[model samples]
Target: MKHIIPYIAIILLATVIIYSNAEKERTRITERCQDTFSDAIRTEKKLLIKQFCMQYRQENSPNSLSVEDKKDWYDQNYLIATSPSRHQLDSLFRDGAHKINRNISTAIGYTFNGKNYFSGDESCRKSVIPVQECVYRKDTISTTDIALQAYIHIPFYVPLQNTYTYAVVLMASVALAVCFLYTRRRKKNMTGIPLQELPETGNVTPVIPRKVQTEKWMKLTDGYQWNPQNHMIEHAGKTVILRGEALRFFQKFIVDKHFFLSYSEICRLYHLKEETNGAKDRAYHSIKQLKDNVAELGIEIKSIRGKGYKLLFSHRNRQII
Candidate 1:
Protein backbone atom coordinates (compact mmCIF):
# COMPACT_ATOMS: atom_id res chain seq x y z
CA MET A 1 0.00 0.00 0.00
CA LYS A 2 2.80 2.40 0.83
CA HIS A 3 4.58 1.70 -2.48
CA ILE A 4 1.36 2.32 -4.47
CA ILE A 5 0.85 5.88 -3.11
CA PRO A 6 3.05 7.67 -5.67
CA TYR A 7 1.36 5.93 -8.63
CA ILE A 8 -2.09 6.87 -7.27
CA ALA A 9 -1.06 10.53 -6.96
CA ILE A 10 0.27 10.60 -10.53
CA ILE A 11 -2.99 9.19 -11.91
CA LEU A 12 -5.15 11.76 -10.07
CA LEU A 13 -2.99 14.70 -11.18
CA ALA A 14 -3.10 13.60 -14.81
CA THR A 15 -6.87 13.18 -14.74
CA VAL A 16 -7.58 16.63 -13.27
CA ILE A 17 -5.25 18.50 -15.63
CA ILE A 18 -6.56 16.69 -18.73
CA TYR A 19 -10.17 17.36 -17.73
CA SER A 20 -9.52 21.11 -17.17
CA ASN A 21 -7.75 21.52 -20.53
CA ALA A 22 -10.52 19.66 -22.38
CA GLU A 23 -13.14 22.02 -20.94
CA LYS A 24 -11.15 25.07 -22.10
CA GLU A 25 -10.86 23.67 -25.63
CA ARG A 26 -14.59 22.92 -25.76
CA THR A 27 -15.33 26.54 -24.78
CA ARG A 28 -13.14 27.87 -27.62
CA ILE A 29 -14.98 25.72 -30.20
CA THR A 30 -18.39 26.82 -28.91
CA GLU A 31 -17.50 30.53 -29.29
CA ARG A 32 -16.29 30.12 -32.88
CA CYS A 33 -19.50 28.28 -33.79
CA GLN A 34 -21.64 31.03 -32.19
CA ASP A 35 -19.92 33.76 -34.25
CA THR A 36 -20.54 31.81 -37.44
CA PHE A 37 -24.21 31.38 -36.59
CA SER A 38 -24.67 35.05 -35.66
CA ASP A 39 -23.13 36.33 -38.92
CA ALA A 40 -25.40 34.12 -41.05
CA ILE A 41 -28.57 35.18 -39.13
CA ARG A 42 -27.79 38.92 -39.26
CA THR A 43 -26.98 38.92 -43.00
CA GLU A 44 -30.22 37.08 -43.86
CA LYS A 45 -32.32 39.41 -41.67
CA LYS A 46 -30.81 42.51 -43.42
CA LEU A 47 -31.69 41.15 -46.85
CA LEU A 48 -35.31 40.43 -45.86
CA ILE A 49 -35.81 44.01 -44.48
CA LYS A 50 -34.34 45.50 -47.66
CA GLN A 51 -36.77 43.47 -49.84
CA PHE A 52 -39.76 44.55 -47.68
CA CYS A 53 -38.85 48.26 -48.16
CA MET A 54 -38.23 47.84 -51.90
CA GLN A 55 -41.95 47.35 -52.57
CA TYR A 56 -42.76 50.90 -51.41
CA ARG A 57 -40.17 52.54 -53.73
CA GLN A 58 -41.39 50.50 -56.74
CA GLU A 59 -44.79 52.29 -56.66
CA ASN A 60 -43.12 55.68 -57.61
CA SER A 61 -41.36 54.18 -60.68
CA PRO A 62 -42.59 54.43 -64.29
CA ASN A 63 -44.27 51.05 -63.86
CA SER A 64 -46.70 52.58 -61.30
CA LEU A 65 -50.26 53.16 -62.65
CA SER A 66 -50.83 56.52 -60.80
CA VAL A 67 -49.34 58.89 -58.16
CA GLU A 68 -52.30 58.29 -55.79
CA ASP A 69 -51.42 54.54 -55.52
CA LYS A 70 -47.74 55.35 -54.77
CA LYS A 71 -48.70 57.57 -51.77
CA ASP A 72 -51.01 54.84 -50.43
CA TRP A 73 -48.28 52.16 -50.87
CA TYR A 74 -45.71 54.17 -48.88
CA ASP A 75 -48.19 54.64 -46.00
CA GLN A 76 -48.99 50.93 -45.85
CA ASN A 77 -45.30 49.80 -45.87
CA TYR A 78 -43.92 52.27 -43.26
CA LEU A 79 -44.45 49.96 -40.22
CA ILE A 80 -43.73 46.74 -42.08
CA ALA A 81 -40.52 45.90 -40.10
CA THR A 82 -42.19 46.56 -36.66
CA SER A 83 -44.81 43.92 -37.53
CA PRO A 84 -42.50 41.74 -39.67
CA SER A 85 -44.02 38.82 -41.58
CA ARG A 86 -42.89 35.52 -40.01
CA HIS A 87 -43.70 33.49 -43.14
CA GLN A 88 -41.57 35.81 -45.31
CA LEU A 89 -38.62 35.75 -42.81
CA ASP A 90 -38.84 32.00 -42.44
CA SER A 91 -38.32 31.64 -46.15
CA LEU A 92 -34.89 33.38 -45.82
CA PHE A 93 -33.86 31.60 -42.57
CA ARG A 94 -31.68 28.56 -43.08
CA ASP A 95 -29.62 26.20 -40.89
CA GLY A 96 -26.27 27.75 -41.77
CA ALA A 97 -24.10 25.46 -39.58
CA HIS A 98 -22.70 22.10 -40.68
CA LYS A 99 -24.78 19.07 -39.71
CA ILE A 100 -22.05 17.92 -37.34
CA ASN A 101 -19.79 20.28 -35.35
CA ARG A 102 -16.53 18.27 -35.11
CA ASN A 103 -18.58 15.03 -35.10
CA ILE A 104 -20.91 16.30 -32.36
CA SER A 105 -24.59 16.93 -33.18
CA THR A 106 -25.41 20.68 -33.58
CA ALA A 107 -28.59 22.65 -34.33
CA ILE A 108 -29.33 26.29 -35.22
CA GLY A 109 -32.63 28.03 -34.35
CA TYR A 110 -34.27 31.49 -34.11
CA THR A 111 -37.00 32.64 -31.72
CA PHE A 112 -39.33 35.57 -32.44
CA ASN A 113 -42.68 36.44 -30.87
CA GLY A 114 -42.43 33.31 -28.68
CA LYS A 115 -42.22 31.02 -31.77
CA ASN A 116 -39.15 28.93 -32.69
CA TYR A 117 -38.14 28.06 -36.28
CA PHE A 118 -35.24 25.81 -37.32
CA SER A 119 -34.39 23.26 -40.00
CA GLY A 120 -32.28 21.13 -37.63
CA ASP A 121 -32.79 19.13 -34.41
CA GLU A 122 -36.04 19.92 -32.59
CA SER A 123 -34.26 19.86 -29.21
CA CYS A 124 -32.21 23.02 -30.02
CA ARG A 125 -33.34 26.02 -27.98
CA LYS A 126 -32.32 29.68 -27.82
CA SER A 127 -29.26 30.38 -25.67
CA VAL A 128 -26.98 33.34 -24.93
CA ILE A 129 -23.43 33.08 -26.22
CA PRO A 130 -20.88 32.33 -23.43
CA VAL A 131 -23.96 31.79 -21.23
CA GLN A 132 -23.04 34.45 -18.60
CA GLU A 133 -22.61 38.23 -18.68
CA CYS A 134 -19.25 37.86 -16.91
CA VAL A 135 -18.44 34.49 -18.42
CA TYR A 136 -14.77 34.14 -17.55
CA ARG A 137 -15.37 35.32 -14.00
CA LYS A 138 -17.86 38.24 -14.01
CA ASP A 139 -18.73 39.30 -17.57
CA THR A 140 -21.76 38.81 -19.85
CA ILE A 141 -22.62 38.51 -23.56
CA SER A 142 -24.08 41.40 -25.61
CA THR A 143 -27.86 41.91 -25.72
CA THR A 144 -30.09 43.59 -28.36
CA ASP A 145 -33.67 44.82 -28.83
CA ILE A 146 -34.12 42.33 -31.68
CA ALA A 147 -36.10 39.30 -30.53
CA LEU A 148 -34.10 36.94 -32.78
CA GLN A 149 -31.64 34.67 -30.84
CA ALA A 150 -29.71 31.58 -31.97
CA TYR A 151 -29.50 28.13 -30.36
CA ILE A 152 -25.89 27.20 -29.46
CA HIS A 153 -25.46 23.84 -27.71
CA ILE A 154 -23.41 20.78 -28.67
CA PRO A 155 -25.42 17.89 -27.32
CA PHE A 156 -23.48 14.91 -25.81
CA TYR A 157 -20.22 16.35 -27.09
CA VAL A 158 -17.04 14.31 -26.59
CA PRO A 159 -13.85 16.01 -25.36
CA LEU A 160 -11.76 14.94 -28.31
CA GLN A 161 -10.90 18.39 -29.66
CA ASN A 162 -8.85 18.52 -32.86
CA THR A 163 -6.15 20.75 -31.35
CA TYR A 164 -3.46 18.83 -29.38
CA THR A 165 -1.06 21.55 -28.21
CA TYR A 166 -2.69 21.96 -24.79
CA ALA A 167 -3.03 18.20 -24.33
CA VAL A 168 0.64 17.69 -25.18
CA VAL A 169 1.73 20.32 -22.66
CA LEU A 170 -0.48 18.76 -19.96
CA MET A 171 0.96 15.28 -20.55
CA ALA A 172 4.54 16.60 -20.48
CA SER A 173 3.93 18.40 -17.16
CA VAL A 174 2.46 15.29 -15.52
CA ALA A 175 5.34 13.16 -16.75
CA LEU A 176 7.84 15.61 -15.29
CA ALA A 177 6.00 15.62 -11.95
CA VAL A 178 5.98 11.82 -11.79
CA CYS A 179 9.67 11.68 -12.67
CA PHE A 180 10.54 14.23 -9.99
CA LEU A 181 8.68 12.26 -7.32
CA TYR A 182 10.45 9.00 -8.25
CA THR A 183 13.87 10.69 -8.42
CA ARG A 184 13.40 12.32 -5.02
CA ARG A 185 12.42 9.03 -3.42
CA ARG A 186 15.44 7.29 -4.96
CA LYS A 187 17.74 10.05 -3.75
CA LYS A 188 16.46 9.66 -0.17
CA ASN A 189 17.23 5.91 -0.21
CA MET A 190 20.67 6.51 -1.66
CA THR A 191 21.45 8.99 1.12
CA GLY A 192 22.06 6.98 4.33
CA ILE A 193 24.56 7.34 7.17
CA PRO A 194 28.07 7.49 5.65
CA LEU A 195 29.95 4.52 7.11
CA GLN A 196 33.15 6.59 6.98
CA GLU A 197 34.06 10.02 5.57
CA LEU A 198 36.64 8.28 3.31
CA PRO A 199 37.50 4.67 2.60
CA GLU A 200 40.93 3.14 3.15
CA THR A 201 43.05 1.71 0.20
CA GLY A 202 40.48 3.25 -2.23
CA ASN A 203 38.06 0.41 -1.41
CA VAL A 204 34.30 0.50 -0.65
CA THR A 205 33.58 -0.23 3.03
CA PRO A 206 31.17 -3.02 3.87
CA VAL A 207 28.06 -1.77 5.72
CA ILE A 208 28.10 -2.66 9.44
CA PRO A 209 24.75 -2.71 11.27
CA ARG A 210 24.45 0.56 13.18
CA LYS A 211 22.36 1.12 16.34
CA VAL A 212 19.24 3.18 15.67
CA GLN A 213 19.61 6.69 17.14
CA THR A 214 17.00 7.27 19.85
CA GLU A 215 16.54 9.34 23.07
CA LYS A 216 14.57 6.79 25.07
CA TRP A 217 16.55 4.53 27.49
CA MET A 218 14.81 2.50 30.21
CA LYS A 219 16.26 3.52 33.62
CA LEU A 220 16.39 0.55 35.96
CA THR A 221 18.44 1.79 38.93
CA ASP A 222 20.28 5.07 39.60
CA GLY A 223 23.36 3.68 37.82
CA TYR A 224 21.63 0.93 35.73
CA GLN A 225 20.12 1.73 32.32
CA TRP A 226 18.71 -0.46 29.56
CA ASN A 227 19.73 0.41 25.98
CA PRO A 228 16.79 -1.20 24.17
CA GLN A 229 18.24 -0.34 20.77
CA ASN A 230 21.15 -2.73 21.49
CA HIS A 231 19.33 -4.86 24.08
CA MET A 232 22.17 -4.27 26.57
CA ILE A 233 21.81 -3.30 30.23
CA GLU A 234 24.60 -1.18 31.79
CA HIS A 235 25.66 -0.71 35.41
CA ALA A 236 28.91 0.52 37.00
CA GLY A 237 30.89 0.33 33.74
CA LYS A 238 29.60 -3.26 33.11
CA THR A 239 27.23 -4.21 30.29
CA VAL A 240 25.06 -7.37 30.17
CA ILE A 241 23.42 -8.28 26.91
CA LEU A 242 20.07 -10.17 26.98
CA ARG A 243 18.62 -11.73 23.82
CA GLY A 244 15.81 -14.03 22.60
CA GLU A 245 13.04 -15.04 25.06
CA ALA A 246 15.07 -13.79 28.03
CA LEU A 247 15.11 -10.27 26.63
CA ARG A 248 11.37 -10.31 25.96
CA PHE A 249 10.52 -11.62 29.46
CA PHE A 250 12.81 -8.99 31.01
CA GLN A 251 10.99 -6.21 29.17
CA LYS A 252 7.60 -7.61 30.23
CA PHE A 253 8.71 -7.92 33.86
CA ILE A 254 9.50 -4.21 33.99
CA VAL A 255 5.86 -3.37 33.21
CA ASP A 256 4.19 -5.94 35.47
CA LYS A 257 3.07 -4.91 39.01
CA HIS A 258 5.36 -6.16 41.84
CA PHE A 259 7.86 -7.04 39.11
CA PHE A 260 6.09 -10.48 38.90
CA LEU A 261 5.81 -13.22 36.25
CA SER A 262 3.54 -16.28 36.43
CA TYR A 263 4.36 -19.60 34.74
CA SER A 264 1.46 -19.17 32.30
CA GLU A 265 2.51 -15.59 31.55
CA ILE A 266 6.06 -16.71 30.85
CA CYS A 267 4.78 -19.49 28.55
CA ARG A 268 2.67 -16.94 26.64
CA LEU A 269 5.64 -14.56 26.26
CA TYR A 270 7.83 -17.32 24.75
CA HIS A 271 4.78 -18.75 22.83
CA LEU A 272 5.22 -22.17 24.47
CA LYS A 273 2.29 -24.58 24.98
CA GLU A 274 0.50 -23.74 28.24
CA GLU A 275 -0.89 -26.17 30.93
CA THR A 276 1.26 -28.98 29.48
CA ASN A 277 3.92 -31.20 31.03
CA GLY A 278 7.28 -29.44 31.60
CA ALA A 279 5.57 -26.04 31.06
CA LYS A 280 6.83 -24.80 34.45
CA ASP A 281 10.34 -26.12 33.74
CA ARG A 282 10.40 -24.32 30.32
CA ALA A 283 9.19 -21.09 31.95
CA TYR A 284 11.76 -21.47 34.74
CA HIS A 285 14.65 -21.95 32.33
CA SER A 286 13.76 -18.83 30.30
CA ILE A 287 13.37 -16.74 33.43
CA LYS A 288 16.59 -18.21 34.91
CA GLN A 289 18.70 -16.84 32.07
CA LEU A 290 17.26 -13.30 32.57
CA LYS A 291 17.66 -13.64 36.38
CA ASP A 292 21.30 -14.78 36.15
CA ASN A 293 22.25 -11.86 33.82
CA VAL A 294 20.79 -9.12 36.11
CA ALA A 295 22.14 -10.79 39.31
CA GLU A 296 25.53 -9.22 38.60
CA LEU A 297 23.87 -5.79 39.16
CA GLY A 298 22.66 -6.87 42.68
CA ILE A 299 19.10 -7.79 41.55
CA GLU A 300 17.70 -11.10 42.71
CA ILE A 301 14.80 -13.30 41.54
CA LYS A 302 12.76 -15.12 44.20
CA SER A 303 10.39 -18.03 43.42
CA ILE A 304 6.96 -18.40 45.17
CA ARG A 305 5.60 -21.95 45.45
CA GLY A 306 2.54 -22.71 43.18
CA LYS A 307 2.47 -19.00 42.08
CA GLY A 308 5.13 -17.05 40.15
CA TYR A 309 8.55 -15.33 40.28
CA LYS A 310 9.39 -11.76 41.41
CA LEU A 311 12.43 -9.46 41.13
CA LEU A 312 13.77 -8.22 44.50
CA PHE A 313 15.94 -5.08 44.77
CA SER A 314 18.36 -4.50 47.60
CA HIS A 315 18.44 -1.25 49.64
CA ARG A 316 21.73 -0.27 47.94
CA ASN A 317 20.31 -1.05 44.42
CA ARG A 318 16.80 0.36 44.77
CA GLN A 319 14.83 0.70 41.46
CA ILE A 320 14.76 4.22 40.04
CA ILE A 321 11.51 3.60 38.14
Candidate 2:
Protein backbone atom coordinates (compact mmCIF):
# COMPACT_ATOMS: atom_id res chain seq x y z
CA MET A 1 0.00 0.00 0.00
CA LYS A 2 2.83 2.44 0.90
CA HIS A 3 4.64 1.63 -2.37
CA ILE A 4 1.39 2.08 -4.36
CA ILE A 5 0.79 5.50 -2.71
CA PRO A 6 4.31 6.66 -3.59
CA TYR A 7 3.82 5.60 -7.21
CA ILE A 8 0.50 7.37 -7.44
CA ALA A 9 2.11 10.59 -6.06
CA ILE A 10 4.94 10.33 -8.58
CA ILE A 11 2.47 9.87 -11.46
CA LEU A 12 0.43 12.88 -10.35
CA LEU A 13 3.55 15.08 -10.09
CA ALA A 14 4.69 13.95 -13.56
CA THR A 15 1.24 14.69 -15.01
CA VAL A 16 1.24 18.22 -13.56
CA ILE A 17 4.75 18.97 -14.91
CA ILE A 18 3.79 17.63 -18.34
CA TYR A 19 0.54 19.66 -18.45
CA SER A 20 2.40 22.89 -17.49
CA ASN A 21 5.12 22.34 -20.08
CA ALA A 22 2.49 21.55 -22.75
CA GLU A 23 0.62 24.73 -21.93
CA LYS A 24 3.91 26.70 -22.14
CA GLU A 25 4.78 25.03 -25.44
CA ARG A 26 1.36 25.73 -26.84
CA THR A 27 1.73 29.37 -25.80
CA ARG A 28 5.14 29.47 -27.46
CA ILE A 29 3.73 27.82 -30.58
CA THR A 30 0.85 30.29 -30.75
CA GLU A 31 3.39 33.13 -30.40
CA ARG A 32 5.60 31.71 -33.15
CA CYS A 33 2.70 31.47 -35.61
CA GLN A 34 3.22 34.93 -37.15
CA ASP A 35 4.39 34.64 -40.81
CA THR A 36 5.58 36.86 -43.65
CA PHE A 37 6.02 35.78 -47.29
CA SER A 38 8.62 37.64 -49.41
CA ASP A 39 7.49 37.32 -53.04
CA ALA A 40 3.97 38.48 -53.91
CA ILE A 41 2.41 39.64 -57.22
CA ARG A 42 -0.59 42.02 -56.67
CA THR A 43 -0.37 45.14 -54.54
CA GLU A 44 -3.44 44.02 -52.66
CA LYS A 45 -1.96 40.55 -52.05
CA LYS A 46 1.29 42.05 -50.76
CA LEU A 47 -0.64 44.37 -48.47
CA LEU A 48 -2.79 41.49 -47.25
CA ILE A 49 0.24 39.32 -46.41
CA LYS A 50 1.96 42.26 -44.68
CA GLN A 51 -1.14 43.00 -42.63
CA PHE A 52 -1.64 39.33 -41.70
CA CYS A 53 1.96 39.02 -40.57
CA MET A 54 1.73 42.26 -38.60
CA GLN A 55 -1.49 41.19 -36.90
CA TYR A 56 0.05 37.84 -35.93
CA ARG A 57 3.12 39.60 -34.49
CA GLN A 58 0.91 41.99 -32.50
CA GLU A 59 -1.24 39.12 -31.15
CA ASN A 60 1.59 36.70 -30.30
CA SER A 61 4.50 38.99 -29.40
CA PRO A 62 8.15 37.83 -28.93
CA ASN A 63 7.43 34.81 -31.18
CA SER A 64 5.01 34.74 -34.11
CA LEU A 65 4.34 32.88 -37.41
CA SER A 66 2.97 29.34 -37.26
CA VAL A 67 3.62 26.82 -40.04
CA GLU A 68 -0.10 26.81 -40.93
CA ASP A 69 -0.24 30.64 -41.18
CA LYS A 70 2.95 30.60 -43.26
CA LYS A 71 1.44 28.02 -45.59
CA ASP A 72 -1.80 29.98 -45.86
CA TRP A 73 0.16 33.17 -46.72
CA TYR A 74 2.16 31.38 -49.45
CA ASP A 75 -0.92 29.68 -50.95
CA GLN A 76 -2.87 32.90 -51.10
CA ASN A 77 -0.11 35.06 -52.64
CA TYR A 78 1.62 32.41 -54.72
CA LEU A 79 -1.64 31.46 -56.48
CA ILE A 80 -1.46 34.77 -58.38
CA ALA A 81 1.95 33.76 -59.87
CA THR A 82 1.66 29.95 -59.98
CA SER A 83 -1.25 27.52 -59.58
CA PRO A 84 -1.06 24.81 -56.91
CA SER A 85 -1.16 21.18 -58.28
CA ARG A 86 -2.45 19.79 -54.97
CA HIS A 87 -5.43 21.09 -52.92
CA GLN A 88 -2.99 21.84 -50.10
CA LEU A 89 0.70 22.88 -50.08
CA ASP A 90 2.07 19.82 -48.31
CA SER A 91 5.65 21.08 -48.17
CA LEU A 92 4.73 24.19 -46.13
CA PHE A 93 2.02 22.86 -43.82
CA ARG A 94 1.32 19.29 -42.50
CA ASP A 95 4.83 19.06 -41.17
CA GLY A 96 5.06 20.08 -37.50
CA ALA A 97 8.64 20.93 -38.56
CA HIS A 98 9.75 24.51 -39.13
CA LYS A 99 12.22 25.75 -41.77
CA ILE A 100 15.63 26.65 -40.35
CA ASN A 101 18.52 28.83 -41.60
CA ARG A 102 18.67 27.68 -45.21
CA ASN A 103 20.12 29.84 -48.02
CA ILE A 104 17.30 30.30 -50.55
CA SER A 105 19.27 31.19 -53.72
CA THR A 106 16.60 33.23 -55.50
CA ALA A 107 16.61 30.97 -58.63
CA ILE A 108 17.40 27.51 -57.13
CA GLY A 109 15.54 27.60 -53.72
CA TYR A 110 15.71 24.79 -51.09
CA THR A 111 15.16 21.07 -51.83
CA PHE A 112 14.01 17.89 -50.01
CA ASN A 113 14.85 14.47 -51.60
CA GLY A 114 12.31 11.71 -52.57
CA LYS A 115 9.25 13.95 -51.73
CA ASN A 116 7.98 16.57 -54.16
CA TYR A 117 6.90 17.92 -50.73
CA PHE A 118 10.36 19.56 -50.43
CA SER A 119 11.34 20.00 -54.07
CA GLY A 120 12.01 23.11 -56.13
CA ASP A 121 12.75 26.58 -54.67
CA GLU A 122 10.46 25.95 -51.70
CA SER A 123 11.99 29.30 -50.72
CA CYS A 124 10.52 32.72 -51.62
CA ARG A 125 11.60 33.96 -55.10
CA LYS A 126 10.91 37.04 -57.21
CA SER A 127 11.21 36.34 -60.94
CA VAL A 128 14.64 34.70 -61.56
CA ILE A 129 16.09 36.99 -58.81
CA PRO A 130 16.26 36.38 -55.06
CA VAL A 131 14.91 39.59 -53.36
CA GLN A 132 14.68 38.52 -49.71
CA GLU A 133 15.10 35.53 -47.37
CA CYS A 134 12.62 33.81 -45.00
CA VAL A 135 14.15 32.58 -41.72
CA TYR A 136 12.28 30.61 -39.03
CA ARG A 137 12.65 29.67 -35.33
CA LYS A 138 12.28 26.25 -33.74
CA ASP A 139 11.27 25.01 -30.30
CA THR A 140 13.69 23.00 -28.10
CA ILE A 141 12.92 21.17 -24.85
CA SER A 142 14.91 21.39 -21.60
CA THR A 143 15.42 18.32 -19.35
CA THR A 144 14.43 20.11 -16.12
CA ASP A 145 11.12 21.80 -16.82
CA ILE A 146 9.94 24.58 -14.49
CA ALA A 147 6.61 24.31 -12.56
CA LEU A 148 3.80 26.63 -13.61
CA GLN A 149 3.21 29.57 -11.26
CA ALA A 150 -0.35 30.51 -10.17
CA TYR A 151 -1.57 34.12 -9.70
CA ILE A 152 -4.39 34.67 -7.17
CA HIS A 153 -6.58 37.80 -7.20
CA ILE A 154 -8.05 39.60 -4.17
CA PRO A 155 -11.53 38.14 -3.50
CA PHE A 156 -14.39 40.53 -4.29
CA TYR A 157 -16.33 39.35 -1.23
CA VAL A 158 -13.62 40.44 1.24
CA PRO A 159 -14.29 43.52 3.44
CA LEU A 160 -12.22 46.59 2.51
CA GLN A 161 -10.47 48.89 5.01
CA ASN A 162 -12.02 52.28 5.91
CA THR A 163 -9.12 54.49 4.85
CA TYR A 164 -8.85 58.22 5.76
CA THR A 165 -8.75 58.89 2.00
CA TYR A 166 -12.43 58.01 1.54
CA ALA A 167 -13.44 59.91 4.70
CA VAL A 168 -11.56 63.07 3.59
CA VAL A 169 -13.26 62.96 0.19
CA LEU A 170 -16.70 62.66 1.79
CA MET A 171 -15.97 65.52 4.19
CA ALA A 172 -14.74 67.80 1.36
CA SER A 173 -17.86 67.08 -0.69
CA VAL A 174 -20.13 67.96 2.25
CA ALA A 175 -18.19 71.21 2.89
CA LEU A 176 -18.47 72.24 -0.74
CA ALA A 177 -22.21 71.63 -0.78
CA VAL A 178 -22.67 73.64 2.43
CA CYS A 179 -20.54 76.52 1.09
CA PHE A 180 -22.57 76.68 -2.15
CA LEU A 181 -25.86 76.71 -0.23
CA TYR A 182 -24.61 79.43 2.14
CA THR A 183 -23.47 81.62 -0.78
CA ARG A 184 -26.84 81.20 -2.53
CA ARG A 185 -28.73 82.14 0.64
CA ARG A 186 -26.49 85.20 1.18
CA LYS A 187 -27.15 86.47 -2.36
CA LYS A 188 -30.91 86.03 -1.91
CA ASN A 189 -30.86 87.94 1.42
CA MET A 190 -28.87 90.93 0.07
CA THR A 191 -30.78 91.42 -3.22
CA GLY A 192 -33.69 93.19 -1.46
CA ILE A 193 -31.72 96.18 0.07
CA PRO A 194 -32.48 99.78 -1.08
CA LEU A 195 -29.76 101.81 -2.88
CA GLN A 196 -29.54 104.57 -0.15
CA GLU A 197 -28.54 102.13 2.62
CA LEU A 198 -25.88 100.44 0.42
CA PRO A 199 -22.27 101.04 1.37
CA GLU A 200 -21.02 104.37 -0.06
CA THR A 201 -17.50 103.88 -1.37
CA GLY A 202 -15.36 105.44 -4.11
CA ASN A 203 -16.13 109.12 -4.98
CA VAL A 204 -18.49 111.30 -2.85
CA THR A 205 -19.34 114.12 -5.30
CA PRO A 206 -20.24 117.69 -4.13
CA VAL A 207 -23.52 119.08 -5.49
CA ILE A 208 -23.34 122.62 -7.03
CA PRO A 209 -26.52 124.79 -6.80
CA ARG A 210 -27.70 126.77 -9.92
CA LYS A 211 -28.98 130.33 -9.19
CA VAL A 212 -31.31 132.16 -11.69
CA GLN A 213 -31.66 135.97 -11.45
CA THR A 214 -34.49 138.16 -12.77
CA GLU A 215 -34.47 141.71 -14.31
CA LYS A 216 -36.18 144.01 -16.93
CA TRP A 217 -34.66 144.30 -20.41
CA MET A 218 -35.28 148.12 -20.72
CA LYS A 219 -32.61 148.99 -18.18
CA LEU A 220 -29.36 147.62 -19.55
CA THR A 221 -25.91 147.19 -18.18
CA ASP A 222 -25.05 144.02 -20.00
CA GLY A 223 -28.88 143.94 -20.60
CA TYR A 224 -31.51 143.23 -17.92
CA GLN A 225 -31.40 139.67 -16.69
CA TRP A 226 -33.66 137.67 -19.06
CA ASN A 227 -36.39 136.47 -16.72
CA PRO A 228 -39.03 133.92 -17.71
CA GLN A 229 -41.22 135.17 -14.80
CA ASN A 230 -41.46 138.85 -15.97
CA HIS A 231 -44.95 140.32 -16.60
CA MET A 232 -44.38 143.12 -19.21
CA ILE A 233 -42.42 141.26 -21.81
CA GLU A 234 -44.43 138.08 -21.56
CA HIS A 235 -41.98 137.04 -24.22
CA ALA A 236 -39.36 137.03 -21.47
CA GLY A 237 -40.78 133.57 -20.72
CA LYS A 238 -39.25 132.59 -24.03
CA THR A 239 -35.84 134.01 -23.01
CA VAL A 240 -32.98 131.74 -22.10
CA ILE A 241 -29.64 132.59 -20.51
CA LEU A 242 -27.22 133.28 -23.34
CA ARG A 243 -23.49 134.04 -23.21
CA GLY A 244 -22.94 137.70 -22.04
CA GLU A 245 -21.40 138.44 -25.44
CA ALA A 246 -24.25 136.87 -27.52
CA LEU A 247 -26.80 138.72 -25.36
CA ARG A 248 -25.02 142.03 -25.98
CA PHE A 249 -24.91 141.36 -29.72
CA PHE A 250 -28.67 140.56 -29.76
CA GLN A 251 -29.50 143.83 -27.91
CA LYS A 252 -27.71 145.89 -30.59
CA PHE A 253 -29.47 144.07 -33.42
CA ILE A 254 -32.99 143.83 -31.91
CA VAL A 255 -34.22 144.88 -35.41
CA ASP A 256 -37.51 146.83 -35.49
CA LYS A 257 -38.74 145.14 -32.30
CA HIS A 258 -39.29 141.88 -34.23
CA PHE A 259 -36.45 140.64 -36.38
CA PHE A 260 -36.93 137.17 -37.61
CA LEU A 261 -33.64 135.22 -37.26
CA SER A 262 -32.57 131.95 -38.71
CA TYR A 263 -30.47 129.70 -36.48
CA SER A 264 -27.59 130.14 -38.93
CA GLU A 265 -28.03 133.93 -39.11
CA ILE A 266 -27.80 134.07 -35.31
CA CYS A 267 -24.53 132.13 -35.57
CA ARG A 268 -23.33 134.68 -38.19
CA LEU A 269 -24.64 138.07 -36.79
CA TYR A 270 -22.50 137.68 -33.78
CA HIS A 271 -19.03 138.43 -35.11
CA LEU A 272 -19.54 136.08 -32.23
CA LYS A 273 -17.71 133.45 -34.23
CA GLU A 274 -17.24 130.05 -32.59
CA GLU A 275 -13.47 130.03 -33.27
CA THR A 276 -12.68 128.50 -29.84
CA ASN A 277 -13.77 124.99 -28.82
CA GLY A 278 -15.41 126.26 -25.59
CA ALA A 279 -17.23 129.06 -27.54
CA LYS A 280 -18.74 126.63 -30.08
CA ASP A 281 -19.84 124.20 -27.34
CA ARG A 282 -21.40 127.04 -25.27
CA ALA A 283 -23.17 128.49 -28.33
CA TYR A 284 -24.84 125.18 -29.16
CA HIS A 285 -25.96 124.67 -25.55
CA SER A 286 -27.34 128.23 -25.36
CA ILE A 287 -29.36 127.97 -28.59
CA LYS A 288 -30.75 124.54 -27.70
CA GLN A 289 -31.74 125.80 -24.25
CA LEU A 290 -33.44 128.92 -25.77
CA LYS A 291 -35.47 126.91 -28.27
CA ASP A 292 -36.52 124.31 -25.71
CA ASN A 293 -37.45 126.72 -22.87
CA VAL A 294 -39.33 129.14 -25.21
CA ALA A 295 -41.57 126.34 -26.42
CA GLU A 296 -43.32 126.38 -23.01
CA LEU A 297 -44.08 130.16 -23.22
CA GLY A 298 -47.28 129.92 -25.43
CA ILE A 299 -45.23 131.74 -28.11
CA GLU A 300 -44.54 129.53 -31.17
CA ILE A 301 -41.05 129.56 -32.69
CA LYS A 302 -41.61 128.71 -36.38
CA SER A 303 -39.19 126.75 -38.57
CA ILE A 304 -39.73 127.49 -42.31
CA ARG A 305 -38.00 124.64 -44.16
CA GLY A 306 -35.45 126.51 -46.30
CA LYS A 307 -35.74 129.59 -44.08
CA GLY A 308 -35.36 129.47 -40.28
CA TYR A 309 -36.75 130.57 -36.85
CA LYS A 310 -39.24 133.43 -36.31
CA LEU A 311 -40.79 134.20 -32.93
CA LEU A 312 -44.52 135.22 -32.78
CA PHE A 313 -46.74 135.76 -29.74
CA SER A 314 -50.54 135.69 -30.16
CA HIS A 315 -52.66 138.73 -29.23
CA ARG A 316 -56.23 139.72 -30.30
CA ASN A 317 -57.26 137.70 -33.41
CA ARG A 318 -53.89 138.31 -35.08
CA GLN A 319 -50.86 136.18 -34.26
CA ILE A 320 -48.34 138.83 -35.31
CA ILE A 321 -49.42 137.40 -38.66
Best by lDDT: 1
Model 2 alpha-carbon miss at residue 262, Å: 3.6
Q: What lDDT would candidate 1 get against the real structure?
A: 0.53
Model 2 residue runs over 4 Å out of place are 1-253, 270-285, 314-318
Residues 211-251 of candidate 1: C-alpha lDDT, one tens digit per residue: 87765678765776778888887778888889865788788
lDDT of 2 by residue, 1-321 (tens): 432554455456554655555455433332222111121122224443454332334455443434543454444434423433322232232121133112111121221121222223433322222221222122112221111111111122111222433454455566556656776797688797865656869987899898877564552112223332342223433344444333433333334345465545554643334343223333333443354444454434444555444544434312333
Please give the range of 10 consecutive residues that has the lowest summed lDDT in model 1: 131-140
Clash totals for all models, in order? Answer: 6, 8
Worst 10 residues of 2 by lDDT: 145-154
TM-score of each: 0.33, 0.20
lDDT of each: 0.53, 0.36
